[model samples]
Target chain A: MEKLQEINNKAALNASGALSKLIDRPVKMNITMADVRKVEELSPVIGPEEIVAGVYLPVTGEITGAALLIFPKESSFNLSDLLVRREPGTTRKLTGLDKSALKELGNIVCGSYLTVFSNALQVKIIGHVPSFSFDMFGAIVSQIITEFVQKSEKALVVEIEIIFELKALKGYFLLLFELPQFNAILRSLDSV
Target chain B: MMENIEVNMGDLVVTKNQDKLTTSAVGSCLVITLYDLKFKIGALAHTMLTDRRVSHLKRDALDATSSSARTREGGNERRHEIRDMKYVDAAIDEMIKKMVTQGANKENLEAKLVGGANMFPALKSDIGKENVLAAKKKLKEEGIRLVGESVGGSQGRSVEFSVASGIVTVKIKF
Candidate 1:
């Protein structure tokens, strides 16, 4: 709850404006707010064997937690060659319609960051059914922080970086709750 | 002794001489290293599952499904000296009882399994082969001595355990 970093940077720019209207392009998102360091001070931002292409969502009701969406295997085969239209590296080996178009583009960028965390923290969060891991960004974030960092050493990260066209894709949008569902989303952000 | 010791993701770390425990990528997640080569010690774990008593991180609903747990209730002494390492049977029983209370003998233990791969072959029972059969049944029921393994397939690996030259330098990534 480090002051919810400006409501997690406006919920990562409304999840990068819903991924620039469904990947039409020009999607740039940047929001880094980790006020809980200690899982070895995070650091190694994707390297433990690289690979990457994870998206383990779990944002259930009234703000529960978990939402990771990493991508680095050449930014997920260059965004799965523009999410399936194909060309560049021709979806380089990600088979089957480019792994279901990168899990349908990680289910529309994690359902637009859980609909901007349920309408900018109003509540009712939900992002279920998201389970995709291309693996090894240290074993998919070591299975995305096993048991939510054992009940919180303080984790509410939200570092998303998704620049498009010119090509750039980074990840991490973890938000494992505890501490009364993060003070119940900081008291429902004071009635939004 | 900070010679480059970094074991995040469920975490684990232990050292002795020239330290060097590293952990990266290792998809499906699993990197259990316990050297103790006559007290050069070692101990490195990076589990993501293979046992936390089979699923328990209970977040409520990931809708996709509520998630599993990683148990992080700390009081520090290095969190009870490297607690749970996020399961692989409670991180090789808490790094073999902290490497025999830091004297490390237990018959000169020596195991080195790294990154159980299987990235994502459409998921169905292959949490990297159940974290490589729970790290070879807890290193053969604690009789230790598994020697070495790079495990499964589907790329991504980046290990580096030295602990005074016991040597483990994997770097796959394909």
Candidate 2:
């Protein structure tokens, strides 16, 4: 578990570096938690009723699972402003352009994390096209959990704290893998 | 003071008093409530999937819950097998049975439904729609009158079902 956490920390760092490069700004991210959890325990990180923007990327290949990136309402708008080059705090509602920008941002962040894992474990991982949704935090997360419940009962949850320009943002990046695939991942790490 | 009971995912709560049953962050999952006005008894279920029969993880989930059902608190160990109440069909049936057991008249029971939202439109998943349909079908089979519902959208909803008034309030973040 410690080794897995360490790998996730490195992956988080890689994701932050990629995000900084994309937005052309210095971005800092801290991995608040990196551990395995039951699917039921994954939705309470943010208030269920709180509005949030989520980017979901279905992962295939050696691991059949999904990756989810979440941002609270204010942080989503704030990040959208930065991603689309609008004045900070100006994005009240997400437009098509802003949504696309968010999806692109999700792709980059998830891709970076997958890249690090693939390199570390010598596993081929593919992230499909990203899907975006903005809704209640519980609702968004429930859909993903339901999707995975058809296959697995557990997930690897990674909570992250993102800071940009002195404004701290609470975000979550979750990875879900089937039990066998998850064990394979751990075994690969053991060999490493 | 009216008591408030929280219903978690794949769980059901039945009461004969004025307690309010609440559940939040409902996306794709279905919340079914049954009430008998004359008896003043009601039950609420937070169901996750359409049907357990069609689910591939039914065996695994049940086995997992069975083992994890043991808990030690204050040096006392307790063991209880938890039924996977997340299936719409099973959950609604269980709720009706519980309501009847709690003195709710089967003939006088009315029903309300909430949740069942496709939070991600791009995913093209029909679990939400399927769950809603399954619940409706179950209610019909059970002869429960469908009184009110707030369902089938891209919005997440939080629900509060008052057993006293048979009033179901659904809230969503605009």
Candidate 3:
């Protein structure tokens, strides 16, 4: 019990340090109840009342599983406008010229989360081109979890809410780490 | 008086008098054409799927008038008229008929096929392969000889046919 507790504490410290380094600032690390609230409130669009959506990285250990970043239709459009510098009321759908911007945003958000994981765990990870779809959040989450998550013994999921004031857009980032990869990180923390 | 007719997706167009018919950037789709050199008539069908299973529900109304109407007519006239209808099977059959109507013998008519590219890599369903197989089966059943074909690859193709010469030129891009 003592050894496992030491490992867990060390892992948490390592994760915190890594996130701070990656963001170039100290990050308050933990999937605590408070952090959950922060994730929700950061964006006015994704408040505490909204349902928790799932974003998956299916091939997590193998070249990074497919990562799905879900945003509300309105939030997605707002983010697209901010990312592309489009004027308000651009009348463009997310599927139109905004596809490229969405892709880039996914890359950045997913990359940031993975950077934290890699630094804390000392693992090298790479991601592929991101694909986005606007659908009922539950349906999308269920699909990803069934296709990618259920196959694993366990998964490390980090849920964060991102806010951009320019667009008044709020959305969640669900990072799913594969079981084996998470275990390896745990082991590294034990030795550390 | 010969004028070229351009065929787009989900469409069939026929022309006589040596006019050229063309379609561009065909991906995961089949382009089948029957030309009658003597009659100077030709028809082309660009189909995205091998079977009508999915389209069956959506195309039921259109199919009712198309399939049964062709069966009621006799050889050349029936074939030519049916080819005037849309969809894969009828379009090929009609092309052969139109060729015969234009004075080309059924046995002497030549069929040319092109396109069938796997455009979506993530999709495991091989629509392109299915289209190629369906085109081959349809042509064989109709007793139309396929003199030339360019099918089945990851690249897109653009095809142009000369009804006057019964020649099909296919340009492929990787």
lDDT of each: 0.67, 0.81, 0.54
Identify the candidate with maximal DockQ.
Answer: 2
Per-residue lDDT over B1-174 for candidate 1, one digit per residue giving the tens place of the 0 to 100 score? 558887876668877769788876666677888887766888898876765235433422211121322234564322122234566887888888888888888788889888666655444436677878888987898788898888877666888998997889988755
Off by over 4 Å in 3: A1-192, B55-86
Best candidate (score: TM-score): 2
lDDT tens per residue, model 2, A34-128: 77787667556677788888999988887678898988889899988888999888999999999999999888877877777777777888999
- Candidate 3 lDDT at B68 equals 49
Off by over 4 Å in 1: A1-50, A54-66, A70-75, A83-108, A111-113, A124-138, A143-148, A151-176, A179-192, B1-44, B47-167
On a 0 to 100 scale, what is the lDDT of residue A96 in model 3? 50
Could you list the CA RMSD of all candidates, in the order they appear?
15.2, 4.8, 16.9
Better of 2 and 3 by DockQ: 2
- Cα deviation of B95, candidate 2, in Å: 1.4
Flag clash pairs in model 3: A58-A65, A59-A65, A60-A65, B28-B117, B39-B102, B83-B94
Query: Residues A48-153, candidate 1, lDDT per residue (tens digit)?
Result: 5556677676666765667666677777887777766677666666776676667766767667656766776666877777667665565555544543444234
Q: Which prediction has the highest lDDT against the true structure?
A: 2
Clashing residue pair totals per candidate (backbone < 3 A): 23, 0, 6
Better of 1 and 3 by lDDT: 1
TM-score of chain A of 2: 0.88
